[model samples]
Target chain A: EAGVAQSPRYKIIEKRQSVAFWCNPISGHATLYWYQQILGQGPKLLIQFQNNGVVDDSQLPKDRFSAERLKGVDSTLKIQPAKLEDSAVYLCASSLFIGGAVKQQFFGPGTRLTVL
Target chain B: DQQVKQNSPSLSVQEGRISILNCDYTNSMFDYFLWYKKYPAEGPTFLISISSIKDKNEDGRFTVFLNKSAKHLSLHIVPSQPGDSAVYFCAAGGGTGTASKLTFGTGTRLQVTL
Candidate 1:
């Protein structure tokens, strides 16, 4: 079976530029999540989308960060006026959120963003 | 403040020996726990998990032990192999009775040497 897929595995941008990463989850997974993983640290949840609607985005920096999961299958995470601190690996994950507690989340090969 | 923490940044174990990686969480409400493994440039892959109601759960060579009172959990790999060397992350999930979004630990780099 195919795992979650993400685009532009690596990205480099200037501190003030805008960057976007895309993710395509496995078929039929309902819950989608975006996380930022800094070097030497764990991946922190930025936002979560259930179907086409958002569940949690409290950690998202709304002023510069944005994400949309249209049609409920694919998602895009955008960072505008990127700050140097935003340089990190952007990971996309999905899960079968329908049954039993929480199932294992399948992760995509993250997009490593480097903001210079 | 970090809710989940893996104090040891790395651990070295001899091949065929047992390797234990530990994690601690601050939230008492977390009801589900999981361990993930990741290689460089790849995303994390789920290893195993234990529900809050259970003190122990085992899967083949991997076992997860939870001590809810202490808010601590550990993952033990038996007869550790070089192929098992990777960064291990412990995550906690549970809330609102839905599939939980996870809160991950910093990660522990496990190296199995011959």
Candidate 2:
């Protein structure tokens, strides 16, 4: 089966500029997630979507970052006025949610954003 | 605050030897633990997982042991292969309404040499 798919494997933007990343999760997957991985650190959860509805986004910086999954299939994460500290890899993951049971999450290659 | 931590930043082992990576978590709410392996420029892939009820779980050459009292876990690879070289991350999740929300460790880089 095909795994999660992301676009623009790499991106470069100047500080204060805006950037967007796209993600298309595995077909039939009910849960989607966005994460940020800084150098030498593990991936940190940014937001989660359960069928186009947000499940969790407590860690997301609302002042600069936002994400949406309109159809529950594909998602987009956007950052406005990007800062140097925002330079990191953006990873998208999906999993099948069954009766609230924990499932393995399949990840995409990720989009590396470099803010200069 | 960092709930999960992999204190060892890196480890090197000769081929055909055993490799052990350790992880510690401070959150008592975590009841499910998972290990993921990642290569450079690639996203992490699920390797193995264990529930709190089980002290040990093994799949082929990879085994994960969880000690609830100590809030520590470990991954052991026997007869390690060169292909096993990658960054290993430990993740934890549990509690009501947060089973799917995982907290990950900083990761431990492991290299196998021949």
The estimated TM-scores of all candidates read 0.97, 0.98
Model 2 chain B: ten consecutive residues of lowest lDDT = B93-102
Q: Each prediction's DockQ?
A: 0.72, 0.65
How well is each residue in A28-116 modelled by candidate 1, as lDDT tens digits? 89889999999999999999998999999999999999999999999999999899999999999999855554578889999999988
lDDT of 2 at A48: 92
Relative to the unseen true structure, what is the C-alpha lDDT of residue A42 in candidate 1, on a scale of 0 to 100? Answer: 99
DockQ of 1: 0.72
* Stretches > 4 Å off in candidate 1: A98-100, B96-99
Residue by residue across B1-114, what tens digits does model 1's lDDT show? 899999999999999999999999998878888999999999999999888879999999999999999999999999899999999999988564333778999999999999
- The alpha-carbon deviation from the true structure for residue A78 of candidate 1, after best TM-score superposition, in angstroms, is 0.5
State the iRMSD of every prediction, in order shown.
1.8, 2.1
C-alpha lDDT of residue A86 in model 2: 100
Docking class of 2: medium
State which candidate has the highest lDDT. Answer: 2
* Residue pairs whose backbone atoms clash in candidate 1: none
